[model samples]
Target: MTNSKNTGLVPPSAFALGGDLNVTRIGYGAMRLADGPERPADPAAAAIWRPPADRAAALDVLRAAVEAGVNLIDTADAYALGANEELVAEALHPYAEGVAVATKIGVLRPAPDEWVPLGHPAYLRQQAELALRRLKVDRLDLLYLHRLDPAYPIAEQVGTLRRLQEEGKVRHIGLSEVTVDQVREARETAPIAAVQNLYNLATRGHEAVVDYAAEHGIAFVPFFPIAMGAHAGPDGPVAEVARQIGATPAQTALAWLLRRSDTIVPIPGTSSAAHLKENLAALELALSDEQFAALSALGQDEAADGVAA
Candidate 1:
C-alpha cells in the first residue's frame, strides 16, 4: 500500500457477487486471454482458421490469477468464437473450490464482423448448454445476457435466463451494457444479480446506472476499466498521484473505481501475467478522500469547456 514494493501480496478484499458467490473485489477478465478480437471483421474465416492462444501461457495466467486470490473470472461466448471458454476449461477444468467462473450468451457471430442477437428461449437455452460444456461445469457460477436483443422483449430475454436458473444450468443471471431503466425492467422479470457496463475515468455517462446498482445491492462490473485522456497524461493528476503513491496510472484508475462504490467490480483484462499482477496490485493503493474525489470529478473541467467527457 506504499511506494516500496511488497512481495507475496494478498489480493484486495472479497465481494459477494449475487449476495452469495464470494469473489475478490479485484478480478480478472478472460477476454484478453482469448487472443482474438471481440468482433472479427472475418469471424467466419477466423473461426475456420484462427489459431488458439499460447496454451501454456494462458494456463499460467489462469493459475496465477487464482493463486493471486482472484476468485471471479469474466468472459463471453462471442469471444474467440468459444475458444476462450474452452481455454479456460483446459486451464482450470477441475476448478478449485471458491473459484467462480462467469460467462455470457445472447450474442452470436454469423458472418464476417457481424453480430446477431439470439434471445429466443430456445437459442438461449442451447447456448447455456454449450457454454456449460465448453467451461466443463455442471452449473455456471454466473451467466450474463451479453447485451439486450433489440428484436426481442427484454422480459423474454431475462425470463429465458430465469428458466435456465430453474433448470439448474446457471446459479445467477445478469445483464450487460444496460441502462438504469433496463436494469429495473429486467429485475421485474427475473432477479437481476449483476450489471456490466462500459465505465472508466474517461466516461461517466453511466453514473446513474452505477448508483442504482449500488442502492439495489447489485454488483456493477465495469469492463475496459482503465485510465485515459487527461487522467493518463504523464504530468496530469493521475500520474502525479500514482507517482506520489508508487503505482501506475492504470492502477490508480482501478483504485479510484474500487472506492467509487462497494458494488463496483472492475474486471481489468490483460494478456501478460506481469500486467495482470500489476493491475491486481492496485488494490493495495488506497486513496485518501481528496484523491478519490479528484478522480471521481475527472473530465468535469473539459465538459465545462464544451469538451466531450
Candidate 2:
C-alpha cells in the first residue's frame, strides 16, 4: 500500500467531545474484534459470538490503532459477552495520553444473534460497574446506552447514566440507534456527548439525526459507516467516483462522511491491521464540490428505494 503519510497526507481532524475530550475524526470500532473461530449454522444467528481466533493478533490490532494516532476506540459490553472490553484493556490499558475508550451498555445477548434491550435502572448501573471492571478503568471515558428499551421511560434510562456521571464512574453519556426526538428527550435527563447510529452512503435512515446533531453541537458517531449499496457496483456512481478520486470504494464512502458534517465521526471497524491503516488513510481524501454532491445524491436515491440498512 502507498504510504499516505510520506506523501504529505493530512492526518484525521480532531473534535472536542462534550467540550472536554478531544478525539480524532476517524475512530476505530472494536465490535469486529469479536470475530472468532466459531460461526453458527444459522445465518441469522451469526453475530459477535466468541473470542477471536487469534487473541494475540486482536490485541496487536488494538495497540497498533492507538500507535497510528487513533484516540477514540469504540466497543461495547455486549460484544462477546464483554470480552471485547477485556481485550481492549489487555491491549491498551494504561492507555496513552488523550486516548478515549468508549463503550455501550443496556443490551443483552441471550443467544448468538438475539439482542434484547434491558434498560432497567439497576441493570444499567450493574453493567456500568462491570464495564469499569473489565476495562480496568476508574472512569469510563464515554459510555453509551446501546439501545432504548421501549418499555422503560427515556428519563429513567438516561437518568441512570446521569447518576453514574455524578458518581464519577462515567465521564460522558451517549445513545445509540435513537431518533431525533429521543435525543431531545434524553437530553432532558442528561447531557448527551454523542449519538451512535447505523448510517452510511447507502443507508440514510438517520439523515435528519445527523443534521440535528450538527446543529446541536453533539457528536454523531456512525456505525457500519463504510457500507455502500448496489450503486457501488463497477459501473455505478461509487465506482465512477472512486476511480476519479484514486481511492477504494470504502475510502470514498468515508470521505463523504467526513465532509457530511463537522460534528460527524465515523468509527469503521476492522480486524486486519492493514485494513485499519487503509481506513485511516481516508482522512487525507479530499472530494471536490461536484464529487461530494454526486456521492451525496447516492444516499438520496437509496433512501427513495426504501433501503432499510
Candidate 3:
C-alpha cells in the first residue's frame, strides 16, 4: 500500500477536461476571487468565507498556480455572480496555449448571496454569450450547465448547449451536480466532456457518477476539495494517514482523490499564495491503498449521514 517510488516529488498526470485538452491532475478554482459580501473583505478572517490575503496577492496566487503547471481553471457565472470569471480572465488572459478555462452557466445569483436555478433555454444561451464576452474568448474551452432545472426538460437544456456547440461558441459541453441518468440524457444531445460536483474526502454522494465518468473517459472535477474541516479532525483517519506521510489532512484528501481515479481532477480554491501552493503540493503526496481505503470509508460514513437525513 506504500509507494516507494515517491522521491517526495508530486506525481504528474494529465486529464483531458473534454476536447483535445489535457492538463495536470491539480487544477485551480476561482470562486474565491470575487470582492463581495459572499467573500471576506479581509483575507485573514475564516468567518469571511472564500477571502483572499489581498487583491494583489490573490492575483499572484493565481499566476503562481498556473506557473506551477495548473492548467485547468474552474469558475462559474454565479460565483461572485460573474466576478470570478472576470478575475480569472484578468489573471490568465493572453492565456498560455493548452490552458483551459471551464466556466458554467444555468445557475443565477440574483443577489451576491443567493443562488437560484435559471436554466431556461433563453437564459442558458444568454449566459453563455455573456461568459464568452467576459472571458474575452471566441470559444469557451468547456462550458457547463451549472445545474439541471426541474422546471424544464433536460433535453431542452442540453439541446440549447448543443446548438451553442454547433455554432462554435462552446468547444465542449459539461454538467454540474448531475446524476448518472442525467449524464446519459445529456450525451444524447451533445458530447459531454466533464462533470463538476461537490465532492471531497467528506462528501461522496456522486460516487456513481465519478466512477461512471472514469470508466467512460469523462473528467470529474470536484469542488470544495478541502471542506472536510472538523470531520478530518486530529486523530481522525485522514489526520492519521496525513501524519504518517508528513502531509496535511487537506493535502492527504487531495492526494487520495488523485489516486482514486485518473479522470478525477480536484480544483481546490484559495486566494492565498501560501495555501494555494500547499494545495497544489498534494500532487506530490502519493497515498497508499490503506490510506485510500480509510478515507473512502470516511466518505461513506458521511454519505450515510446525508441519506439518514
Candidate 4:
C-alpha cells in the first residue's frame, strides 16, 4: 500500500499553530541547551543544573537551529531554574520574524533530579512574568503549563493562563503531559493551542491525545520524538525499516512521526548541530503504507512490552 501524496518524500513544510504562528514542522527542543553529562550510565542520572559547560557553543547551537529553518524553539523555566530561558534570550533576544520561542512554567526543580509541580494561580502568574523577563520578550510566543498540579483545579490553572492571555502576556496557551479529559477541562477555561507530551515511534502512551489534538486543530508537540530504544538496534525492527528507507533508525523514527500526523510538531532536542541536521532531514524521507504499518506494529509491540513490564 502507498499514499499517493506522501509516496514521493513530501512533508508538509509548515504547520499553522493556533491558526497563526506558522512554524516549520520539524522544531528544536531547547532542553539540551545546558551543559550536562551527555550520556550518563543511567539516563535518569543526568541533570541540567548550570549553564552550558561551554556557553558559547550552546548559544551557537541555538542560533544554528534557527539559521537552519527551525522556527519553534521549546524551553522551560524549570531548566537550570530559569538559566535556560536566559540562554534562549541571550542567543536570540530580538527574535527574527517567524521565530516562535515557547517556554513552560509551573514546575519547581529544587534538586537536580527532583521535579515538582506548583500550580497556584499566584505562582503561575509570577512565573509567566519572570519568563517574559528571562526571555526578554514583552509577550511570550507560547506558554505551556509544564505539568498539571493535582492539588489545584484544572480550571484554576488554565484560568490563570487565560487571564495572562487576556493581559497579552501570552499569545497562545499550551499544556504538557495531559489527558484528553484534562484538555477538555482546560478548553472550558481557555483555548489550548498545543499539547506537549512524551510521544514517539516507540512510545504510544499518548496515542489518543495525539488523535484528539489533531481532530481539534491543536498542535501535538512530542518532546522525546526520536526515541527508538533497543528495537532500533541492528537487525531489529527499526533498523530493518531504516535500511529499507535509506536512513538511520533515528531518522526513520522521526519520519514515521512526521507521516503520522500533520498536527504533530516534533521537538527532537540535540546539543550537536550535526545530529540536529540529521533529525531534520527526516522530513524528506517519506514512508509508504507498508513501511508505516510495519513501524506502527513495532510501536504497538514495544508499547505492550512496556505495559507488561
What are the clash counts of all predictions, listed in order? Answer: 0, 0, 1, 1
- Give one digit per residue, the lDDT tens place, for model 1 in 1-309: 555532223334667888899878888888776544457666543542222547788788988888877888998888777878887888887999999899999988765366677788888888889999999998999999998998899999999999889988899899998988889899988998888888888877678888899899898999989947766999988888787667899998988888788888889887678888998888777777766777777855533443232
**Candidate 3 residue pairs in backbone clash:** 10-284
**Candidate 2 lDDT trough over 10 residues, lowest sum:** 1-10
Task: Give the lDDT of residue 302 in candidate 3.
Answer: 65
What lDDT is obtained when candidate 3 is compared to the true structure? 0.81
Better of 1 and 2 by TM-score: 2
In candidate 4, position 301 carries an lDDT of: 63
lDDT of 3 by residue, 192-220 (tens): 99999898887878888888999889999
The list of candidate 1 runs beyond 4 A from truth reads 3-12, 36-51, 301-309
lDDT of each: 0.81, 0.89, 0.81, 0.88
**Residues forming the 10-long window of minimal summed lDDT in candidate 4:** 1-10
Candidate 4 lDDT over residue span 105-151, tens digit each: 99987766678999999999999999999999999999999999999
The C-alpha TM-scores of every prediction are 0.89, 0.93, 0.89, 0.93
Q: Give the distance in Å from residue 11's predicted Cα in candidate 4 to where it truly belongs.
A: 3.0
